[model samples]
Each structure stands twice: as C-alpha cells, then as structure tokens.
Target chain A: MKSFVVARDLLREAASRRWFLALGLGITLMLVVMGLSLRMDVVDGALAATRLFGKSMNTQIRAADVALRPAFVASSYLIFYGGLLFGVVACADFGPSLLAPGRIEHLLSLPVRRFELVVGTFLGVLALALLGALYGAGGLVLIFGVKTGVFSGRLIVSALLASVTFSAIYGAMLTVAIAARSAALSAASGGALVLLGIVAGERERIAEFFDSGISRTIFRGLTLFLPRVSSLARSAGEIAGSEPVDPAALTSMLLGLVVFGLAALSLGIHLFERKDF
Target chain B: MRRVAWLVAFAALLGLSAFLMSRGDKPKKPERVLKAEFPRHPRDWEEERNRKRRTLPPAAPRPGEDEGIQRKRDPLLVALPVEKGKSSVVFEVAALKESPIGQIWLDCMLEEQAENKRRGRGRDDFKERFGIDLLQDVERIAMSSSKVAVLSVAQGAGRFDKSGWPKRTFGEKGAIWEDTEGRSVFATWGDELVLAGVDVKEIEAAIARLESKSPPQAPPIPDWSAYGDIYGVLSPEELADMLPEEQGEIAARIRAAIDRVDLHVDTSEDVAIVADVNGSNMDDVTDLAKSMGAALSLARAGAEDQGDDRLRELLDYATIKPRDGRFTVDVALPLEVLKQMGPCRKRDAAPSSSQ
Candidate 1:
C-alpha cells in the first residue's frame, strides 16, 4: 500500500513533465515512419524468398494462415516495443539537477523511505515506458489488421511486450542515473549503454570475433538481468496471434531477463537505501 | 492523399509478407510439364522422349512429376580394374617455393605435354586466365611453410574411384574439386609447392585401371605388408592380361628395384619418392604420382595421416609451429637438396623454373 502511493506520486510527477510528452511524441513519430519502411522491406523479402524458392513453397497455406508471422514482427517492431528507445535525449536532463537538488533527501523527508523513493521513481518510469510500449504496439496491431485482415491480440501484446523489454533497458539506465553523483554522468552512462546494446546487436562482424565460448557465456549472463529488455521483443514476435514464437529462444531470454531484473532491482534498492543524500 | 498512399504501401508490404509467410511447402513448378509447340519437329520430341526413357531405364518419373529427392541407393562399385589404358604419370616436382603442388602438377603436366607438343586441354591455356587468382595464393600462403588449416566447403572433386569419393576436410571450407580433362596444375608460390586442381577423374580412372596388376612394375611396390599393401593383387590370369606398358614397367622393375622410401631406398638409381604433402592435391591425394610420368609418392589427402594418434604423430614427426593458434606442419627432407642436383629436378625446384 505504501509502495502504491509512491508509485502513483512517481507516475504523476513524470506525467506532468513536458520532456516525457516530448519523448512520447518523438517515439510515436519514429515508429510511424519505421513501421512504414519495415512493411515494405518485409514484404519485399517475403516475395523474393517465395518467388525464387516458390516451387518449393506450397501455395495452399496462403488462404488458411491468418496470424501475425515472425517475419512481420521482426520487420515491424525491431526495437519499438522491446521497451527500448533509440532517442534518449529525454534523459539528457539528468546532468546535475538530480544530484544538485538532493531530490533523494527531499523524498526521504516525505513519508517515503529510501527504498520507497527508488520504487516510486522506477514505477513512474515504467508507466511512461508502458505508454511508449502501447504507442508502438498499437501501431503494429493497426498495421497487422490493415495488412492481413487478421485482428490478433497476440501480435499487439507481443509488440507491447517488446516495447516493454526496451523500456527495461531504459529502466536500467534510469537506475544508473539514480546512483550517479551528477545527472550528466548518469545520462551519459545510460545513453552510452543503450547505444552499446544497439551497436552490439547490429554488429555481426565484430560479434563474430567474440563469438567464442567465453562470449556466449557472457551473453547468457547478461540476458538474465535484463530479461524484459532482451526477451520482450522476442516474446512479442512469438506470442503474436496465429503463429507461435520459437519456444527455445523465448524461454532462454525470458529466464535471462528475470534473473537480471530481480538482481538489478534489489541492488538498486540497497544502493538507494545506503546512499548519502 | 499522401497518408492514404503511405497506408497503401504499408498495407501492400504487410499483405505481401503475410502471403509469402503462408505459402505451404512444395508448390507446383512449371518445368516438367512439357508443352511441345512442335510444328513439324516430331523428330526432336521423339528424340527427347527416347533420351528421357534411356536415362530412366527403370521407369522413374521425371523430377517435376516426382516427389522429393531420389533415394535410390546406388550400388555402383568402382573397386576394380577399369578399361586397359596407359597412364602417363606427369611429374610436377616443385618442392621448392613450397610451390603449391597443384600449380606444379599443372606446370609439369603442361611441360610433359609441351614435350609431346599437344594443345586444347580441358581448360583453355588461352581464354583469359581467371586473372592473377588470389585463390592461387590460398594454397601457398594459406597452407605452406607453417601448418595452415584450410576450410573449403565444396569437396566432391577427386574421382570417386567407383566407390563413392571419400571426404577430407584438408582445412578447406568447401568440397574438394577436380576439373575434368585430365589436367592437374602445379605451381610455385615463392618456395611453397602447392596444387590447385588435378584431373581427379583421369587419375581415379587410372587407379581403377591398376587392378590389371600385371607382373609387378617396380621392385619396391610400397610395402603392402602394413597399411594399404597391395589393395589390388593381380592373379596369374590377370598378369597375362596386363597391357604392354605395364609389362615394360614390370620389365624395368626386374632389372633394378626401388627400395622402400623408409628402408634406405637407393637414391643413386631411382628418383626419390618423397611423400611430401606439398601438393595442391594435398587436399585431394588421389592424384599423387599421376602428375609425374613416374609415380612418385602415391598421393592421397593425408591418406597416411589417419586416427588422432596418427595426426598427433604427424604433429610430432613434423616441425611444429603455431599460426593463428593452429599447428603449421613442415616435414623437412635432407634428400631434397639432392633433387636439385639431377635431371629429376622439379620445375619449381629447378634453378630456372618455367615462368
């Protein structure tokens, strides 16, 4: 009950921020453009793959199949719903104000304990993240219905989940912000990590060099803490109505994110509780 | 209107992806259904039908009309003597430059053929060389001097020798290759002897023909007492049926026998048979002695290198070094300098190699 009030306060504070609105609007516009581009590319790929290898493709399944496909999910919501935002300038405001204002102390002065403050802020960020997730997910649902005449709850939810996963990455960044002595450092660290994740995900050639056993072990460990960030998008793809996502990858990533999320949250609470305001 | 256009484009792409995703496996192809617009070309269609019939001796339907891969287990055996023929073992002794053995094989083959003065081999010596082939260096730079690992994916090159061709991952990433037309190329790369290709079919055919095992040709027919000793033994009837050239090689053997390479083989008399793994066909050892008119070391892809124990032994026997965390093997020969002193000089080993 104590946590709920903090959550509500955190949510209200974030909702009142113009920066949050700007972030929300920016993300939606990007999704709108991205969704358009992906729709074309995924279709082009599908046609080419089908045509070249068409003789091998049984056309009989065309009319029978009616769910969101993996290819479409991959194309439409690459980074949108996984709760990850590429434009992170919103958090750029975390330069000095966060620490300079001694907001943690002010919050502690309130009825809230140190842990409550962290929890409340996290909840607030999450609320914002969910809104972002909805924007992205809703777009995907509209696209899927418009494209395939298939209204699927699974795909919309999957897109939502993917958006949420992205949000976790941002959430982790926000935690870094909370710990920083200066908001600039926190924002920088957050932006850099996000950029690193995006770059690492895309860079296959560089990844190939580190594709040794040790690297795989590290990758598995990372997935544990950032389960939502890592597996959310994948789950969205899998759970999208009509087709089931690949169970192995989804399960593994889910396991990874859960372990990591719980650990990071626990660590955050401990740090916030122990820190000097 | 612009919004509608964007929507339509998105919709089109979405529709296309869904359509592509829904295609079931095994869609109909249009090749096998023959619609012959044959107006007065009855003969051609008749010929085509006849050809198809001949190819399908047992009445199997053509591919489009048939389902999935043909699972016919071919019991084709190639473990015996083929037709009687004289195999001129073209010598490509390019031990120096560690010349990629394939290039030396080709060079020696061309040299031997040049001596015979013939042209128009399977690959054109004329129609624009596959230009300063970077791949040519693949053997010398990639395999020579240090122990290098090759990774080729295409491997079905050497003759199947009637039985299916064996697979060797001589570090190449793909299947080994053997160009037909009976020409194996051996070239010099700095000092590494390397091979790029050899007439795998010609040599396999040659080996198959060896089943005629006439009166044993050379005195020291590599001691078959141990591993792979006389795989093909000719009975007395087989001896009598031997080709005349086999008889001559047999006659040459009787006069003076070459000793086992390990058993103090008289280097004074016979061309030294160095089991040098410095040939292009290192990956495809089936074409060993065939490149040289005189069968030197009967080549096989690390044929002698077998089990883990043997591989370990090779690592032991050869000078071991490391490159990119892999062993680079070099089995040096003291007798190699002797190769330079005589008429048996390999082209790459020769003071003046044919450019």
Candidate 2:
C-alpha cells in the first residue's frame, strides 16, 4: 500500500548517508571474516567447548582421525553470537534515518499515501538487506567450497533467510525510531532491543520458550507481526556451518520479513502522518 | 552499485582463499623414531629430582659406565620373547539368524537372544539349550585332570566417574581385580587378563584333544649362562646406532607432545611384555593374544604421541586357554575383549624402576 513510498524514502535516506551503510557493511564483513576463519575441530581453543560432546564408545578413536559430521555443525557455538552482533548493527543503521530531523515532514509532503510509503520503505530495506546477504554469503561459500570441496544450497538459502530475519528487527526498530521524538533515544531503543534479546537468550525460561512448540509458533507470529531479530544470524550460521536451517523456519522468516516490513512501514507512516516534524 | 557488487564478488573470492589456506595445516613427518615409556612416572619433578627415583628404570644411565670397544652382543637383543605362561581366547558374534540390512545390529542380538529363550532354547544354559556355535580353546595347564577352567573379566557397570571422563582400569597398579562379571581377574600374576565362555562338554573334548598334546617343559626362567656372550654387554656401535639426529627428532616430537603432560625427562625402562588371547581354542587363544598386543601397541603409540614416556606395558597374552571355545563353537573370547586392555598405565612409583 502507501508503505512502499515510506520504504523507498528510508532506502534513499540510508543511501545518502553513505558512511552509515559503510559502517553496517564493515561490521558484518568483520563478522563474516571471524566466522569463516574459525576452526571447528578437535583442536584446542574456540573449539574446546565444542569438542566436549557426542561421546563415542570406540576407545581406539584418535583425535586426529575423527571426522566432522556434515551440516551446519561446524559453527554451532558461534552462530548465536554472529546473529546477535549483526542484528544490533543492522537495527542501529536502519533506525537513525526513520527518526532523522525533517524526515517525517518530507515523507508527509509526498503524493503517496502513508500506507504505500510504509510498504515501499519496507520493501526497499528488505531488498537492500537481501543484496548485502548475498555479498557476504557468496564470499563465504567460495572459501568454504575450496576448503571442504562442499557446496550446500541449504547454507546459502538458510543464510539468506537469516539476513531477512535481521532485517525484520531493523525494520521494526525503524518504526519505533520514527515514533520517537529524539534520534538518540530511537537508536538506543533499537540497540536495547537487540541487547535484551542477547542477555535473555540463554536464560532457562527463554530456552524453555524456544523449546516449546506453542512458544515458538507464538513468538514467530509476533516476529512476523512486528519485526524479526533472529533469522539472519541463524542464516549466517547455516552458511558458517553452525545450525541446520529448517524449511519451515525459513518460510516463516521470509514471510515474517514481508509481514513485519509492511507493518513497520505502516506504523512509521501512521506516526509520521500525524507528527509536525 | 554494480561496482559495489563486483567488489563484493572479489571479497567473496578473497574470503574463499583465506578459508582454503587455513585448513591446509599438515605437520611434517619425522624419521628414525625411538620412544621409551615407563608404566608410571611422577608428574611432580621437584619431588622426583629431590627424591630417589624408584624402580631403577631399565634404561637408566649408570655412573660407572663401561664403554668397551670390544664388541659383545647384548643378550636381551637376541633373546626371543619366551612363553611366560601364554594363553589365548577368541569371541566372535556371528549372526545366528540372517541379519537384515538397515537394522541396528546390537538390537538384533538382544532380540535373537530373547527369541531363543521363548523357545526354551536360550543361553540360560549358556551352551546346550542354545545351539549357537561358540567354541573353546584349551592347553594343558593341569597335568593330572583334563579339566580346563575359564575366566572373563569386565568392568563393573557402576557410576565410577559421572563426569564422563575416560577412566581406564586395566594394568592399573598391575593388581588383578575381579570384573563386575566376576569371571576374569584384571591381572592375576604379573600379566594381562583373558576371558572365555564355553560349553563344558565341548571343553571336555578339548581337554581330551589337549591331553594328546605334550606340554613344552622349560625352566621357569631359562638359563642365560650358556648365552653368556651377550651378558652385561653393550657394543659401542649398538649404542651409537641411537644417533644424535635420531634422538633429536624423537625429542622434538616428544617436546611438542609435552604440552599435554607434566613430564620432565625422556627416559623409559624397556621391559619384555607378553600379550595373550583368551579363546576357547588354541588358535583362538593365540589370536586373542595377538589382538591384545595390537591394542596395547595402539595405546602405547597414542600415549607416546602425547609425549608421555610413562604408560607403556610390555605385556603378552599367555597362551593359557581359559576355556576351550574351539572345541564347542558354542563360545569364544567375548567380543568385549577390547575393554580388558585397560587403557592407561598406572602411576609410576620409582623413576628408575626397571619395568
């Protein structure tokens, strides 16, 4: 609807702020480098906690002789950390523009309805995030293919889904920043949401919530309704060989990206339409 | 934007190269290796250096060294590993019924054992009721009676260590302990353990067969006097055969492995070890002994790789057939013989103690 106009404005705003795009891209690049270089094996450090698992009764097994199971198991330990880092940065990058001074007035003056503006901005960021993901992940695949001689379409697809997940959170937070009075508060709010997720991620209660089918469904639904935070890092993990990506989860994430992107776009437009700024 | 895309593609290639290069860490191999290991060496070197290293390690460098240019062969080098009471056993779990593909083997075994029991033909009688062809191998341990006794030892299934640490029990203290099965002893007298389960009727037939076999009558410790030419002898050439370059390589490898250990020296007291198979048949028993040796060798190599020259056991399987599995085909050495090899050597009491 009118949300498409808002999505374009946000993209144009981010494009104009070239440094913001560079910073976000740079941070994600760092995450990719760190993740790609991480050695996942029986070797010591970084992999220590990973090694203390999956018992084999075969005593004759030598550490040097052990084979890694195929899948995203290699980067399992760092997947969450990867998601958390990039999600925070992505959210911060998207939020500032939504709350930038004079932006609401400029958005309102446009001939496009508020809903179309919402849809447009939402689609615009989603497209950009998808493009960024392909760059980051295509590099990962090239290196991983040479090292292991293995290419997994699942990895690329899952990572793409995960990138969208991160974009969802950024989209939602953009809406929040738009609704807020100050850019500083908007960015802080965006950042705080990611931080809170990280801090609360490992709590048993949260773990139980993730473990429960109902909780997963409800939380997933909420993410779709608002904005997502966990998908892109998970997708990155899939590429980095950390977690298996379920088709159902990816579908949910992709669908959530579209839904939340629309919602955030609409919510931002609604807030901007009434604001005098 | 297209340039950005091209740059991203280039970055992808760079990242790919980085990952590929990092995985290529293959260490160089070494040559002419010499690894000496004692059963137990102290981790506390401050205490060991201050105190007398006990057990006069077999390879100790003596103070009053006699480096005679006159070549005399070391008798121990020529001496063959004697049958210090050799024994053997073989345990093969051949599928009685046709095993199905894609099915779990262990589960099939338990199920098969159950089905036979339902038919009142099970291992409850261990031999007769179950016509499973398990065999026995026996040698003349007793001169008077043709009867052969068999023993199998296994670790008791108890929560010994809940931390999931690999706790090895064999050869620890060289003290023989009863398995939870209470069938075999860990180490009865200065050697490894062998286990066998057999049909007694089959064993009787083995005993009759073994009765016709004459026992090799040899001295408890064969006299070394006749072979005195090699006594107390070390040719300079033999000692020099252990070149500095060879030792350096070994030492370097040892040092690399030392990160996993707390050892301070590269001393090992090499001793004669005999490994025997505990089987129902003589061949079975011998094969079991050979396997015991293979398993021990593997363990020794692993411990050596870890840079600890202290957990070697010069053990051989005694050709002593615990039971006659070769006779019955009802049984052989238990398939679980791998468990009997007791993985880690016991702690060292004296650094110089002759192994």
Candidate 3:
C-alpha cells in the first residue's frame, strides 16, 4: 500500500513537471502533420492510389493492408526503440532526484520501507513509459486506421511490449542510480544496456565472427543472461506484418524479461536497505 | 534473516531468467523447399549467372577440321536452308511439351481448341485432319523466312498418312501438293519431315538439299547452341526492325554496332533467357553494353519511384554482362509471376467442361 502511495506521488511529480504535457504535445503535432499531408484513394478495400504532401506514392492498385504493411512494420520498430530511448532519457533524473541528500533523509522518516521506496520508484517510471508509448504508438495507429481504414491491432500490442521491455531497462537504471546517486550514470547505464541487449539478440550470429577459442566462449556466456531486446522488436514487426511467429518462444522471452526486471529491482532494494542514510 | 531472504530471492529470479532465456527458441532457418528457386541474394544470382555462362558447351568443331570429334547434329537445324543474313528460329517442341511451363501452355491451348471445336468454327479434331495428334506427335518446328519445316514423331508410330495428298513428285521420295488457291505449297520429305512455303521453288530446293542433290551448306544454327528449349540467331537487320520507330537513331546505332544475336530460352523451370549480342568490334560492344546497362538502370529506378513492384522485380533480375568481345543479357521470370500472368484458374472450369 505504501508502494502504491509512493508511485502516486511520483506520478504527481511528473504531472507537475509538465513531462506528460510535453509528450502529449509532441504526439499531437505528429498526428496533425500526418492527417493533413496524407491522402488515399480506396476502392473496394484496395488502395487505388496514395499521395503524401500532394505527391503520388503509388500508382497501381493493391489491397490496402498489403500496401501499408511496410509502413506498419517501420512504425512498430520506431515505437519499440524510440520509446525505450525516450524512457531512458525522460525518467533518468527521477530516481536520483528521489535519493537526493535532503529528500532521502526526509523520506526515510516516513512510513515507507527502504525496499518499498525502490520498488515504487521503479513502478512509477514504468508507468511513465507505458503512458508515453500509448500516446505515441496509439496515435500513429489511429491515424493510419482513419486514413487507410485498415486497423491493425499489432501496433498497439507492440506499444505494450515496448513498455514491458522498458521495465527491464528502468530496473537497471534504478539500481545504478541507487548505487551511484548520479542521474548521468543512470541514463548512461540504460543506454549501454540497450546496446548490450541488441548485441545479445544477435549473439549467435555474431559468434561466427570469432575463431574457436576461450574468448568466443566467454563472449557467448557473458551475453547469455541479457534480454534479447532486438529480437522482441523484430517479432513485433513480424506480427505487424501478419507473419507467423512461435507463441511459445514469445511467451518464454517475455517471462524472461519480466523476471530479469524483478531481479534487478530486488538488487537495488538490497543496496538501498544497507545505506546509512 | 529478511535481508538474507531478499538476496536468495534475487539469486533465484536471476537463475530462472537464465533458464527461460535458454529455453527461448533459436531463429529457424527459412523453408525454401516448395518455393520456386530464385536467388535470394544479388551475389548468389551473380554467381549463378557466371556459372551458367561458364558451363555452356564449347562451340562445335568445324567439319573436316576436327576429324576425331564425334557430335550428333540436330537434324532440324540441318534441314533449314542457310542464308547469309537471314534469321532462323527452332523450337524444341517435344522438349518444351515435357516442361512444366509447356504443360500449362499446352493445357491452355488445348482448352481453347476444344472451345473452338464446340463452337463449330474449326476442324472436328486436329489428329483426324493431320493424321497425327497435334499436341502429342509434333517433335520440332524450324522456321526461316517464309518456309516452315515440322518434324513429327508420328512417323515412328506409322501414323503419318499422305494418302489424301496430290502426288506431284519433287526430289526422290518427296511429294508436293499445291493449295486450292495456288498460293502455297506443302511438301513432304521422307516420312518424318513436312515443309510448307509460299514459293514452290524454295520448297523444291529445300527438298533437293535434303536429298543431297546440291552441295551442302553449314546449318544455320550450330548444334552447340541448339540445347535450349527455344534457340535462334537473329540478324542485325531483324533486331533493328524490332525496335520502336521513334528510336530510329538508337536502332541505327545498334545495327552499326551489332553483328548478330544468339538467343536461347530455357523453360524447364523458370523462364531463363540469355541473348548473346556479337558486335563488329570490342569498343563497339563495350559502348553498346554500357548503353544497355544504363537504360536498364534508368527503367528500374523509374519503376521503383512509381512503386511498380512487378516491373521492378523483373528489372532487378535483368543484367547485361560483357565477356569474350560480346555481351549477354540474362533475364528470368519466376513461375509464380508467370502463373499470375496466365489465364485465371477460375475460368479453368470452362476448359474442364469442354474436356
């Protein structure tokens, strides 16, 4: 219950700082630009012609969904990676600001436990990420649906997946901030993890580059525990394109990512509990 | 004790994550077994093109020069009269009829023929009128100028009947019949070869050549180039005439630069066409190849800009490669695209009813 209160307070702080307003304004501007510039001539569920900014893009008629598949795929990827980068940059200062010298002493005097504070901050930042993803990805989906009259649910699902993926990233950011008490270090660590996760997704193919030796073995072993973020993004794109995906693999990967996030948060709480402050 | 429990739970979750990560599926290799064989990468396509060019059989040894060389000449090419600059084309009808593409084409043709028969617009049956099954008995067809020669397997089956023809004898064992209007002549040479022409003198001369009553000339198309389902050599003048009238300057340039074009189409799988254009000189060939490559690139870019994927894909596979003082243009159309271009299967029901 105290964690929920702490999370609510963080949301209030975000709202007071105008972070949500900025995100909403940016998304609205994009939606307006798209709505004003794009035109489609549809006949019997086929796109007879399409134009952007008064310039024709396609001449031959094709099934509306088929013609827009590449656009959906590109949007899904942008949401996945762009949302993570936004969360990393926007939510970085929240943790260090919570653990600031004067605020830490004042918060420690409250009814909340040390672990609850860490868990709350993690949940709060994750909520911010979820809201941002929905506004950005959902706005694009709505625009495409209105213009093309082909509503695909996969982009919305991709937005949700991006938030879940960001949870794992934010957990690490919180852990770094708790240890170092520096916002720059937290954001830098998040950026590095995103890069590492991309490498981890392709580690098997990258392994072929190295010769058979201990160095290759160590590289493989070190990356084995990192979340496969790029693979998740690719799966999102594939789903958007209506391609078949293995549900068992997707479920297992999602579970692994969530568990990793919990583990990182637990480590941060452990570090926070022993601090003198 | 509570702090220790936290550490234990963190360790347990991390271990579980590692296990789950390992359980996640590895990327599956693409399944290409049932799909038509198209090169998935440009480099693979380049290698395939190079390999095909490298593996064409060496040119046939000149007669009387390589006495030890034993090569069976294609009788169809041998039957055609050799003219200095005339274009000749030979269709391996039997081989094409056995290929998948040929089967589709034959099915469509037979269906149309059956429809025509039902409408009372043509012969009741091609086999009855010709004394051989038109679809099954024709082995090869060769054409040059106004003359056409057909080779039939029906001779081996003793189905070739000449009983209804006027028996005006040409060369020995050759008979000629004039059409009712006296505008065309049909001649049969031996049991296997039938020749049709607008001129009686040419048909008689061809028959005389077949009988060796005159001196022999080299076959218009060599045996080495006769391997493909459709093979031919086009004269420079014929090539020039094929171009658009608006491109007269280009046509003139092409005629001045090009000597002849050797064309081949392999329809056993996808339609793979190769045309080798011989030039008057190395520099001319190089310039012509550069122009062709530039034209292809411009067309491909236009297709891409217009978002015409079908034309773009076709242009993607079209390439001009220069080697051995000549240039080869290779193009491939996948069977999938061909199936789409063919008659719709929904209309196939009409054919089945006629069948």
Candidate 4:
C-alpha cells in the first residue's frame, strides 16, 4: 500500500535525522543505569527485599514474587505516563515538519493522497512511540527478570498496553500540529489532554462534587469523549500484579481510547483536505 | 480499499473493547452483621490532634461543662500508663456481652455453668472460688503488664477473706484497699468503680489518674476506643517476650521488625479488625508489610484448598497497607462469614430449640 510505503519512508527519514537512534541510545542508557542501580536481596527464589538507590523499601519472607508486585505496578504507571510524555516530545514535530512548505509541496505533488500522507505520518510516529515503549518498559522487565528470575508476561503485555494508550495522545498531538503548525502548541495540547484524561478517569467522583443539574450533565458530557487513561492504566498495572481486573472495563477503555484517537485523526484529515497551501 | 481496511481494523477494536467491557466485574454487595457497641473517642480527641497539626480551634466541648459530669461518663475506670514498657488490654465487658461473638461466648459459659450446677455446684462455688462472677457482676476488665483489675457492680467489696492476707488502707482519702503481698488490691469509688489489680502502686496510680481533675491523656490507640468494641495496645518488646519458647526465631523477627502493636477488633454487622504494627522506621515497617501481605496470601490459598470458604472469603478482604512508619494489617469479615461460626449458628438455632 502507498500508505505503508510512505510510513516506511517516514521511518527512514526519522532514522536519518537521528531521532530513532537518539531515542534508542537514551533508552539503553536509562535501562543500563536502572539495571545497575536495582538491587534485590533474594533468598531461595523469593525476593526477600528490595533496595532502590541504597534505600531498603520492601521486605518479604518465603513469598514468591509478592514483593516484585509493587515494582511491576510502579513500572506500569511509569510506562503509561512516561510513554505519553515521551511521545509528546518525540512526535510533536513530526506532523508540523511534514507540513513544512517545501516538503508539503513536494509530497503533495507526488502520487500520495493527502489523507494517506496524514495517515502514514500518524502511523509512522505511532510505530516510533511503540518502539520506544518496548525498549524502555521491555528492557526494565528483562533486567528485573534477570535479577529476580521471574520473567513476567504481564509486564510484557503492560508495555504493549502502554503503547496502545499513547496512540490516543499521539492522535490528538497530530491534530493540534496539523491545525496550528506549531510543535509547542501540539505538545502542550497533548500534555493537557493527558491531564484531562486523568481527571476524566475520576469522572464519577467529580460528579459527586456537583448537584444533579445541567452543570453536572455538561461536565459528564465533556468527559465522555476523553479516554479514561488513568483507570485503564491502573487496570493494566493490576493485571501485572495478579490482581483481579474487570475485562469489560478494560475492553471499554481500550475501545474508547482507540475511538478517540481515530476521531482526532479524522478531524485532522478534514482540516488537511481544506488547507489551501 | 485502504480506507476499508482501516475501517475494518477500527471496527474490530471497537468490538474487542466492547467484549472486554462486558467482561468487567460487577460490584460486590456487602452483607450486614452484628457489631460491637462501646464508648469511642470523644470528638475532642481527633479535634485536638487536628488542631495540633493545623493549629485550629479546639474541637472538644467548651470547658464550661462541669467536672462531675465528665468523671461520671469517662469510659475507663483505670488510667493505663501508656508508656514504652507497659502493655495494656481493656475489654468493654458490657459491650462485648452485647456483641454476637460475646453472645456465643456467654452461651458456652452458661452451658458450662449448667453442667456444673447439674453436678450439684451452686453459684456460690463461682463466687467463693473465683471471687467474682463476671456474668453477673463485672462491667469491665482491665489488664496491664503488671496487673489485672476487674470492675464489678456486686456488693461486699471486702468479702474475700483469704488467710494470712494483710490488708492496708492507702490513697489520700484512705478509699483504696490493698493486701500486704500486693497480690490483690481493691477499691470502690461511688457505686460502680470496683477496681482491683496485682500491684498496689499501679492500683493507686490508676485511682489517682481516674480521680484527678485533668482530662485523661491520649491513649496509644486514639481512634480505636472511640470506634471499636474491643481494643488493646501491646508493647512489641513485651509481646515478643510473651512468645512461646519454641517460637524463638519468629519472636526474634517480630522484635526486630516491630516496636509497638495496636490492636482493635470491631465485631458488629461486619468483622472489622486492624493490627497496627509500628516499627523503628518506614523501612522496617515496609518490610513487615510485604511479609504480612505474603502471609495473608498463603493463608488464603491454604484456606481455599481446605474448603474453608468463610476463612478464604475473610482472608480475601485482609490486606497489609503501609501507614506512617507503620503497617496496618486489616481484616474485614462479612456478615455471611460471621454467621458460619458454630456458636453463631447455635444461637440462631436456640429459639427453635425453645419452641
């Protein structure tokens, strides 16, 4: 497909610009530091205790991987919030850069449709974000696995879930960039959306603050479109900890997030089609 | 063609998300059960703490309220010295008797009493031998590391005439009575406060503490007495010493990990219990918390395998959450689970038996 080819070309462009390499290097450095700093005093296959940065934080008896749960959960929160922020920084300019005067003129002159150009660029940035999440979250899992000898599939799935969460944020970032043509605006909007999504996660609690009226209705309606990122990410973390999770809630969250992302992408397409550049 | 493919993918995700949402767990409905009823912390205690923390206005009742009223309503007849070395346990005997567990305990005791009576033993045996009939006379029991005291409503305070017992009259008003051996000290204040303890000094201190005009000092468990039916505080060092000789290693570990232990049990419509174990620092407490969580998980698993559904359900609600430099092991028993107790079932069947 032309879109796939264009996506591949964008990936090559990112590589040439040292974006992917810098991300990979930074992730590797963080992972190495994390690997070195993390110390687990394990006795008889059970994580007896954990010491983070020379401070003993947790201890356990003959419990198997019970101590690793906090780390697993904390790592999930990091991946969810960390990946969102990282994507905002890394993919913020991808859309604006694509719409640059000379680049846009050349790309538009080619056989690639404008929608394809938008979709391809979005997919390309998403792929980059996914790779970054895999490296950062996946590397931590591998390192902890080596140290504790408990290779958790839950951690692996959490990394992928985190990547999926970013797609929603990245979609909004793409829309903001395509509209404003400013990376700063794009990044700020994406960050704001993440914050709003967190608030939306507690929509039920917030509704309790207001009376049952139009104002409450308006607040509830405004949150309907926002992804329940915090709850979804918390559930993802729960999965890793072997805590019970409501599959229906998680599935709804995933579906809601993907729908929000696609809606934003559609809006970007509509804006792109009408642009007279 | 590309748009169609994208649409299909989006549709698939939507379907999957819906399916997942459908699989979400429904909220569980909690069952009601009997609860312990007892005197709780006065509003002033928490207000005082909050004021200390935030420098706010005093939350206690205005000081205009007279001393006579406050003294009469005070929950404990003994003022326990909540110091570093001493451990204190106070049972609200009246409240316990009102609770489901206490009712069962009473039933068992009554059954034992019936058996004793069937053997030609009378109420005099319990009264003469034990020097107290807790079922008929006692209102509350207070125990310290050094002494055990009972408050009774019965008459004739000096009825116990054990031979070779030297009686001494002490206290400012000579209201306190004591034995030379300090084995038993008894005192009567007004009509209700019949206090006794092993140590005359402790008994005097408790009497003076109770009789004093100043407001009682804050206890180790500030909120528990106000909220819980049964509550107690334990010096971790003393508790470790009390451990069985065979459990030397576990005792050592407990001593190493804990500095103080606060226990509160609420057996109302639900069984809500908390054992707050404070350690030397956050690190020690956190370690204890992890171990507690693991132990709970193991216990739950064992209970499940043994088909102890009630225990498994109760343990499922048990958790170890870290507090400020301490860890609280919380267990909430559902009413349904509490009903599973043999005594509770027997009590339910009691009316049927009478019919």
Compare the candidates by DockQ and give the number of the best one. Answer: 3
lDDT, candidates in the order shown: 0.36, 0.36, 0.74, 0.67
Residues B56-171 of candidate 1: C-alpha lDDT, one tens digit per residue: 11223354644353322100111112223211111111222233233433455546555443454323222123222232222111121111111111122222233223433222
DockQ list for all candidates: 0.03, 0.02, 0.18, 0.09
User: Per-residue lDDT of B105-173 in model 3, one digit per residue for the tens?
Assistant: 667666667677887543335456446565566677788854655454457422324435454887676
lDDT agreement of model 2 with the native: 0.36
* Top-lDDT structure, candidate number: 3
Q: Could you give candidate 2's per-residue lDDT for residues B1-355 as a string of tens digits?
A: 5324433443443344223222221111222222322212224542342133122112222345343422222111111112223211111112111222102333443546677688776554344421212222111111111122322122221122332223333322222233354333222211211212223332323222222222222211122211110111112222223436634543343222211111111112211111111222455433332333234344554665776533422211111112232110111121123112222111122233655
What is the Å distance of residue B347 in model 1 from its true position? 60
lDDT of 3: 0.74
Candidate 2 vs candidate 3, TM-score winner: 3
lDDT, candidate 4, A55-168, per-residue tens: 877633333455577778888888878788877776788889999999999999999899899889888877877777777777977888898776778877787888877887
Residue A68 in model 4: lDDT: 72
- Name the docking class for model 3: incorrect
Candidate 4 segments whose C-alpha is farther than 4 A from its true place: A15-23, A44-47, A59-64, A108-111, A149-151, A208-212, A240-243, A274-277, B1-137, B140-355
